[model samples]
Target chain A: MVPTSYYIILSAALFAIGVLGVLIRRNALVVFMSVELMLNAANLVLVAFARERLSIDGQVLVFFVITVAAAEVAVGLALLVAIFRTKHTTDVDEVSTLRG
Target chain B: MESLQIPPVDLRLLTPLLIVVGWASALLLIDVFFVPNGRKKITGYLAMAGLAVAGLAGIPLWNVSGSTFSGMLVLDRYSLALTWIFLIAGALSIAVALDYLPRHEIEQGEYYPLIMFAVGGMILMAQSADLITLFLGIELLSITLYILTGFAYPRVASEEAGIKYLVLGAFAAGFFVYGIALIFGATGTTSLAGIADYLSRQPFAPQDETLFLVGASLVLIGFGFKIALVPFHMWTPDVYEGSPTPVAAFMSVGTKGAALAALLRVTLAMEAARDFWLPLLAVLAAATMIIGNLGALGQSNLKRMLAYSSIGHAGYILLGIMVAAERGAEAFLFYMLAYTLTNLGAFGVLIALEQRGEAAWSIDDFAGLYQRRPMLAVAMALFMFSLAGVPPTAGFMGKFFVFTAAYAGGLGWLVLIGVITSAIAAYYYLRVVVKMFMQEPVRDVRPELTRGLNTEILIAGVATLILGLLPTPIVLLVEQSLVALGG
Candidate 1:
């Protein structure tokens, strides 16, 4: 079995990549995908912790987190679709008529 | 594996949440199937009724102290008081919405129910005794708000706000969940009691300390974004400016209040880590106050200005949370109550004047408002003064308690920063007041607002003044509620 510390480190690395993706991405779709990657990274860490502890709580939390992530994706995609209808683009930079 | 026993459910403890969420979903279905599009106010009224009943249900549970859902949910004076606050905020938001939605041609049936669902999430946040429940509560609230932010379908700005909120809100959730993972790794349990037990033991191993501190910092980052703290408030002005005024108003008060309630609990449960987190939070509180007030100075749009003002208020509220050991929870609760009334009233005035599709919300739009709508102008003045923490308004008393509490806790520097920033806040808050009372009207045409809005303005004005003048009883009530926090 892979060591849990290795799994935690890998999960943290994935989470950092997700964070960078969200920060750098211009397209709303890509930013949203980055958010999903982050959630999945958390899920990975949660599952590895569950395996190491031999407890069900971490796994149960991961299940709820995934369900929530799916709901979030649904909302995000709906918002993107609506935004696309009017703006003709999915770029965050283009949607700045409200800047202060 | 041994057979598992079901956690005995507690219905009485969850009466408020069940009534609000269940009726909200029911109202959504009813609106879709039976109510005509033009008559969606029925659904809105039903949502208000559900909230009223939920508020009443909480009255009986006041002072009740226990944990349910196998220690996942807490029932106490603290949660009960916050339930009343959230319910009132929900109902007032619907009042502001009932007219604004239809007038703006965005009277979707989902708006009221979504607000209910958001309130339901806030109640959950207040009641959560475990980290999982807290994350769920936060996400549920954020997801509904993301949808609600874009409820105006054809408006490009509304859509922009929606996507912005969704992306940042989701990003925040990732931080929250991973923080939970790290805390679980360090503490070996997610329950607050377990964390308290572990932290209470002296001399933690280096690895556990790193995990615990890093985990706690990440969790605070997540909450900081939600509450619009200085370092993480990038989305606030744009989102509040673009979203419909009433939705912005509701989120301004409800989200900050709920997030702070949970933060107070987490701070208490991890009290042994005070040496690690207290100074960090105190600096955060100071920076938030300075930046929020300064940001408000440059905003000309009414909604955006209020958004900045709310950020400033978040800093003041953080002052209360910083002194959670010394009656600060009580101060925090009172400050939230006063803020909800005062801020809602201020936003109500903006909602009254914001013409459909025209964005009639500049500070100049409020010029000569006194000549046309004397009472509305006066109400706006009241909210502004209260927000400025002028004596004899709820905002004044709220600031007094929180600052005094901080001083009592020996956080003199934070209190000083709070006081100085509040003076800076007054200049901007009073700018609106000066416009309403002294300046000439930029235009003669004014939009018609509902009589219900008048009631809302009145409730807010009367409550702000009354609470300001006589804060003793409410302060006592808040003190009673924070008993569990050792206040």
Candidate 2:
């Protein structure tokens, strides 16, 4: 059986990469994908932990996360389309109309 | 397979949530099929009716206390009291939205339903006995808010705020899920009671507790963003300024109220590791107060200023979490009521003056407000004073209790910072008052006054002063409602 530490480390790396993409990406599509990646990273961690503990709760949590991620994508894309219609650009930097 | 014993389902405990959800769903359908475009105000009234029923439903359950659904939900005065606050906030929001939406010509039936769902989610947050339930509650509220924030479509700023909130909200959820994963890894359960049981029995991990602490911190980060603590508060000003006035007003109180409930739950579940979190919350609270106040100093936009003010109020509420052991939870409950009343009143005034197709939130717009609408101007002055923690208003009472509670919990330094930041906050709050009363009206920002808007402002003002001058009833209610965290 694979060691649990390896799974945890890999999940952490994936999560970090996902966050980096969100922080650095300009395009809204890429950012949305990055968020999905982060959710998947967390799902990986949950499944790995479930196996290590022989607990069903972690796997159940993975299912919930996946479901929520789908709903989030639905909303995010709808919003992106709305913004795109007005701004004609998907770049977050270009969407800046609100100023302090 | 042996027959799985079904958990004892108590329908009575769920009355408040059921009322809200059922009303919201039915109202949405009615709006789509039955209600005409010109008569959209009917939906707003219906929303208020639902919220009122929901609030009253809680009265029957005032003394009810237990966990059900395999302990996924709990019913107690703590949750019930917060539920009442959410209901009031929701109804008040609908009242403010009644005329504003139609005036702006962006009247939609969806708005009322969304607010109801959001309030329902907040109720769920307060009652949640498991992390998964809490997460669902947060998402439920967030998703509704995302739609409502952008309800003013074709307006670029509204779309921008909605998109930004959606993206950042999702990002935060990712962190929250990862945190839940880590906590489950360490403790092997997501139930608050189970976690508490695990922590109580497990010997200290010392150097090996990296996973536990990291998970806890990640969860804290998720909440920080929700509560708009300083580092995570960048989205607040933009979102509040761009979102429709009523929606922004709702989120400022509703979201913060719900998030604080969950935060209090999480804090209690991890009481065994107070050594790790106690100081962390202190630093976070202090920083949130300082930054939130200082940020509000230069804001010329009224909505933006209130956004910063809401952030600062969140910081003050954080003090409640920091000192949860010593009357802190009671203080938290009291402060939520006070803040909800005062802040909603402040925003209601803004909603009153806002014109269609133009942002009329500038301080200059408030000039000569005293001359044109003397009563309304005085109400705004009262709200500003309350927000600045001046005496004879609900905000003052809230700060008094919270700071005393924090002081008792050994947060003297944080309390001092709260004091200093609050003093700094007074300048900005007073500036609004000075502009409204002292200066001449630069723009007749006043829209045709609606009876609904007037009722909301008057209720807010009277409630603020009442909560301040005679806080005994609410205070006692809050004190009795502290049945939380297995205590």
Model 2 Cα shift for residue B458 (angstroms): 0.8
Off by over 4 Å in 1: A88-96, B1-4
Query: Model 1 captures what fraction of native contacts?
Result: 0.69
Clashes of each: 0, 4
Q: Cα deviation of B336 in candidate 1 (Å)? A: 0.2
Q: What does each candidate score in C-alpha RMSD? A: 2.0, 2.1
Interface DockQ of each model: 0.65, 0.69
Model 1 clash count equals 0
Tens-digit per-residue lDDT, B1-487, candidate 2: 7998887898788899999999999999999999998898998998899999889888979888888888999998899999999999999999999998888888888899999999999999999989999999999999999999988866779988998998889889989999999998888889998888888886856623678789989998899888888788899999998899999999999999999988998899889889998888878888899999999999999999999999999999999987888999999999999999899999999988898867789988888899989998999999999999999999999999999999999889889999999999999999999998999778757555799999999999999999999999989888888854443
- Model 2 lDDT, residue B283, Cα: 81
